[model samples]
Target chain A: MDPARRLGPAQIDVVAQLGVSTVLLGGIYALVSVGLTLIFGIMRVVNFAHGEFLMLGMYVAFWAYTLLALDPYVVLFVSIPLFFGIGVLTYVLVMRGVIHASHNVQIFTTVGLSTALQNAALVAWTGDYRTVRPWHSAVVIRALGMAFNLSQVVAFAIAVALTLVLFAFMKWTHTGRVMRATAQDHDAATLMGIDTDKVYRLTFAIGIACVGAAGVLVSPLYAAYPTAGLQFVLLAYVVVVLGGLGDMLGAMLGSLIVAAVEVVGSYFFGVAWKEVFYFVLFIAVLVLRPAGLFGQRGAETLGV
Target chain B: MPALAPGRWVAVALFGIVALVPAGVRDAYLLDSVILILLWGALSAAWNVAGGYAGQVSLGHAAFFGIGAYSAALMTARFQQSPWLGLMLGVALSIVAGGVIGYLSNRLRGPYFALSTIAFSQVLLIVASRWRGFTAGSEGIPVPFRPGFWTLGLGHVAWVYLALGVAVLYYGVAIWLETSRVGYQLAGVREDEDAAEALGIASRRLKVYAVTLSAAMTSVVGTFWAQYVGFVDPFYVFSIDLSVRFALNTIIGGIGTGLGPFLGSLLITSLETYLRATFSGMKTGFAGIYLVIYGTALILVVRFVPEGLTGLAARLRVRSSRAHA
Candidate 1:
């Protein structure tokens, strides 16, 4: 609250530097959040286990790089099909039974799944923080007096590319359209001869795979610990809500805003209280626009 | 007294079993385990008041728990006041906080409500962690042992008695709400908010009332927990894990079912404590084996017995009665 402690003339470049770093961090957050929103949008199920899958994905990359000598970038591709299979299996075995259950039941189901995965990781990895040191681990590019980690740039680029591909798939592909139709109205889509169940399965698979890929992408950047994904998971939830629960574009935009606020807030208010600033923002958004910035006017009340 | 109901008889029997645990088992470790069951069960029962009965699922209920622990913990640590005084003060504090949160989530549903609750709790957690001067931050506040009924600084066996009495009182409140007029109204609101509103149930007001009362009850137990542990920290008391545990216990037991939370707490907490004890001294990698099994069990429960143990028991009773007939 002090004037001297507030932004001064010399802090502009530092702000710019923080802003640049945030964009890269935001991209990774967007990738994870998009997957979460997709599942929520299509199935009307909030996947609490989502971060665990991401956590496992990071472990997959870490183990692969450590054990098999495969590069993390390569593991990003290798882990997708595996994660897709896991996602579909999860849907078939667990989600199928509770798809129509009460919201309370659905929430608990995911909560249970989340705990199981988190603890499973704890058991396997022994809570040691491991990081993947790929070939380009130390590569940094400096330009205009600001430095960017090469790996971060790669993640950002890939995230942007994936967002475009997802947009296109939803726009052009028949399966994508069917998925969209199911999301719009499950009953109508079922009536219109679309295999709504299959669509749900595919949407969940794609959604999980997306976050799994994000895990691989971030494996090089952050430590792969038992609870690492939890840190990101809470932030992803804040981002997903900020972007409008089921909106993809909104998720991306919200990520940048969240990332920027987090960076600046931490820089100013101290890192320990970084979450307070955005959580305050998150609460304000909920109070003012429950539907979120990009959400439909009445969408907040629509979820089953 | 009014005619004793069958359900009350079952509750009485369950309490009898719980109260007998300390008497039968003198192993301090085992007694601690049962004591946890009572504490967590009682807290989850409070959660069930709003979350299960009113269908307002909160992931931030630990904020109230933390608030209660701190209110009393701070009072005792700072002023050397009696914890009994802290307990009453915590209840008052939690009611206002929970009421405001309940009111905020009045229009929000599903993820919005869940997210709002998470934010509210995280805000408290951050404040508690950063406001080191007041809270002592993450190092935590340790309450000195001042043994007496007023201070609640009792020895181990006394803790068992105290915890059971509190648990019974909590479960009693839950049973009362289950049969009370307000309980039925809350059930109506939970089943269908729109219909309940149409019937002039004042659903919003009832929800606020439920959450506030639930929070107050949880805070009472929080004070008891602080005294029992003799230490309180921002991280342990206010963590998201604690909030999730309350919800998980309620759901695992049978949300809105009066006897469900206790049954859930008894089963899950006992198993968890047993697991941790068994797995604790194991070599490095095997430390979490118990938790892994426990979490998998949770998944299976949600998968097959989504309605919880009470619902399963009800179904079995119906089947057996039909066969007998």
Candidate 2:
């Protein structure tokens, strides 16, 4: 009757399944956090409405699927572009005014934006949870003697592909270089005749587009609701900070770490405590390394 | 700090009207709305202590509010203890929680600090919901209705007075802090932490004090809210929407001013009531249309009237004075 004897092969298999699932879940988180990191990197403004944007993406996919009979995967093109345009409009109309404002103004402006978007969605769509469960939504694929949701696997693949594409774009594109330079030193970038304002607008758009993409990918697996963004955005913040604020690769890595912690910790402490676990981790990371695991020194002090 | 100013008399007159007007109004709906306005006014003022004066925008104040509520509700429901005692305990616990949050987050400026606070509250919320043995889970704890003086039951009129008293107490504290040397140091910290540190002000300690004071007051307001509703639930009390509403009221009324939070609460509550009445007939989605308007108004206020209604009033006064000259 030794407690150690109770640990069996079945339990180990369960743990292994959890690990694989965590990695897949982390890919989706990485996709969401990457854009958040990019926006924060270039412009020091934390978009509190970032989650709302994801919610918008989900709704877009949901509606397109429901109305146009489009697949969730196919709706990414429309959602991404729509969200990009919305992002650009937000930057132009709202965020631009507060770029030079005080921290209080900046924080509340975005907070206000988040409130408006969330409530407007609630008003427009009601609080009903809508999901697009196309065929193959529940298909299970066995890989390496483990079962995986086919939809989740596809979403994971898309997430990784998008991240790679973004990395390449940032590396090879002139616009990406300009964004990095602006993020490094706004004054210096402007001195070099780079349009920092345009860079900021684009960075915000791209950041939002990333979340929009995530929304489309997630619609098959999850329900879309007005407050859905609130749930994901918190985890995105955790991922962004854990990876190091404004560090792209760090965010991707951080997402996996957070996902692992979430899955493994939930197994031990029950599912309800998962959010508590990550939030504690977030505070600990913030206290121990405010610059984040991959962020540059003194990044935490920027734009504060 | 002047004596017998015309503005002071007007304020005194306004206070007198608010305190005595409830006695004449017998409509339950009107009384309830007034009570809510007073409650929100106190809550927003409490938030303004750390947010407006100290310049640390906390997006997770619902933690302290929920803590205060749950403590009072649980104590009253389980132990049959007086809610007043529970209120005191809640205040103490919230101050401690505030100190912890401040100590952990004071190093972080702006949005980082705000997010940390949100995370902290979210942790508390999860604990509140999961620890069903203590909090009754999401079903929430209900305070047994006892019509007695010790239970602080004195009818709706009495409740109005109680809420008004708390709001006045918060207003008095805010005014005092505004004029005190500590207030100046907090303002310094808000304006620029580095500059404040260089001026020999201990920014961390000061911020902790500000947050603690704010939490203490916020907890009291939570206790009142729980008592008013006769229930306490994790989602109802610890909601991020509640936290956002606190900030919205303060910002709309005028942050860092004595009358700002109160005025903001009055305007917002009235608008909410009016909108609910008008839009209640709509079948779907109309429930939150008021909130949409509120949100848009909040954005507009932040964008154009950063100083809030008080600032706008001051501007008008200066304009008239110059025109007369």
Candidate 3:
């Protein structure tokens, strides 16, 4: 009787749940950060409205599910393209003017954009937090000792897939080569007959589309509100900066580390202490490695 | 100058009329809104010193504001101190905090400063929310009705307006700062840091000075705010919406102008009042819609009338005066 009571089922489950939850959280972090890293890699613009794009994508999922009865994952087809168009529009109409403007104008314009988009969503959706639920259960896997939700699994799969696709494109494609060249030296790329404007438009669109996809994927697991994406967006900024402004590989590794710190700290202290953990991590990184975890000397100027 | 131009005398007269609103208007709700407008205007003007003049563009002045409110409230409520002493201590704390934040982002340009300020504000919010022993956590500490001439009460709206008058006095100081040597130096720093450095101006010192000054002024407003509202809460103090409104007030009126914040506040206040009156049920949604429209208006203004209302007034003055001659 003592042997049977020693290893309680609940205690075993708790240990297993912590391990599984931490890994799943890391996947979510990676997904949120990938697009941010891509945008920084090429344009060097911080995309302050990046979170707004995610919010818009959430609305897309909500509307499609509410109106058309489309699955949340199916809504991705609509969100990705729509967000990409908006991204291109943003790059062409707004970013073009402020590309060479002072830091004041850069921040002012982007902040202005963020405010506009956020308000637009507010007016449209009226601050209601909505969630899309499928007919069946979303939790699919129960392996070893813990269960995995369908949304989280799908989010992880999509993230990994997109990451691989982006990696392959950057390594092989001619247009991708031009993007790298432009990121390295804008004038040199222009002189080399590579159209930098087109590159910028595509890069920005793709980056935004990535967030759009992430939004749709996570709509099932998380409630979508006007300000839902804000916390993650802020965290993504910290991750991007920590990874080095424009380094893709740095983003993935940085996400893992940041996730580990956040999840582990949250477990020990409480859920509310998560932000404290991240801020401390950010400050520590800033103090010890000012250029970032993997940033080069000149990479300080990576993001505009 | 144009014949219809509201001259400096008229502006003075307008403020005089405004100062007597509590006496004139007996409604507590309307008077409270008036106090809110003035407070927001003062905070915006303070923000402009660092953001518009020094080009720091901080999105986190709420930290100082929140800290000041809590400090003042905590002291007056628990320690039984006078409001005036609490006010001074609040400003001092904000100055120190501002100095540290400004130093951290001193080397970084543009959005980094804004981002860091946001970070600091977030941290402040977290601390205020978590430190239940001091802050009372999310429930917030209530300042009781300690109504005395010096205690800063919760009952009389007149006293609140009077406390707000001190904020207006500081706004006067800010106007003076605009025309002074520090103002020009700050402008020089904003336009070209290297050129200012070459001209023997200590750009970093001016930036830190402006930001610290901004923090001090904002904290003073916060002290009065806590007293007027009879409470102090982290969300109420350190909200990003307040920060956005600070930037909006300055930008909508005229980004770098001395009187921009006043005009912007007047316009926005009137608009908000009217909206609340007419669309009370749908205020939040309406405000969201209005913000979108306002954003478009801002873009248009930024594109065509970048100099803002003050510039327009100045232009009309020039044209009409020339015509008269």
Clashes of each: 0, 0, 1
Question: Tens digits of per-residue lDDT for model 3 on A1-304?
Answer: 5877658897688767876776677676776787878887787677777887887777788789999999877777777788889889888888776665556656666667777888888777778889888753365788877787777777777776777787778779988888999989999999999988889889988888888887887777788888887888878877877887778888888887777778778888988889988877776665456566898854442224
Write out the backbone clash pairs for model 2. Answer: none
Candidate 2 residue lDDT tens string, B1-325: 6685443454566567889877689998999998999999999999999888887789999999998898889888988898888899999999899998778656687788898899888988888998888778888898877776678656788898889888888888877878899889889888888899999999999989999899888999998899888888898788888999999999998999878898899999999999888898976778788888877888789889999988898889899999999
CA deviation > 4 Å runs, candidate 1: A1-12, B1-5, B18-26, B285-287
Tens digits of per-residue lDDT for model 1, A1-304 = 5777557644666877898889988988998998899998889888888999999999999999999999878887778899899999999988888888767668777877887788788877788899998877689898777788888889888877777787789779988889999989999999999988799899989888988999998988999987788778888888888888888889999999999999888888888888888888888888888777888877777653
* DockQ for every prediction shown: 0.62, 0.73, 0.42
The candidate that achieves the highest TM-score relative to the unseen native structure = 2
True contacts kept of each: 0.69, 0.76, 0.36
What's the lDDT for residue A181 in model 1?
92
Candidate 2 local lDDT, A27-127, one digit each (tens): 99999899998888788888888999889988998999899999988888777788899889999988998887776788888888888899899988989
Stretches off by above 4 angstroms in model 2 are A1-12, A302-304, B4-10
lDDT of each model, Cα atoms only? 0.84, 0.87, 0.76
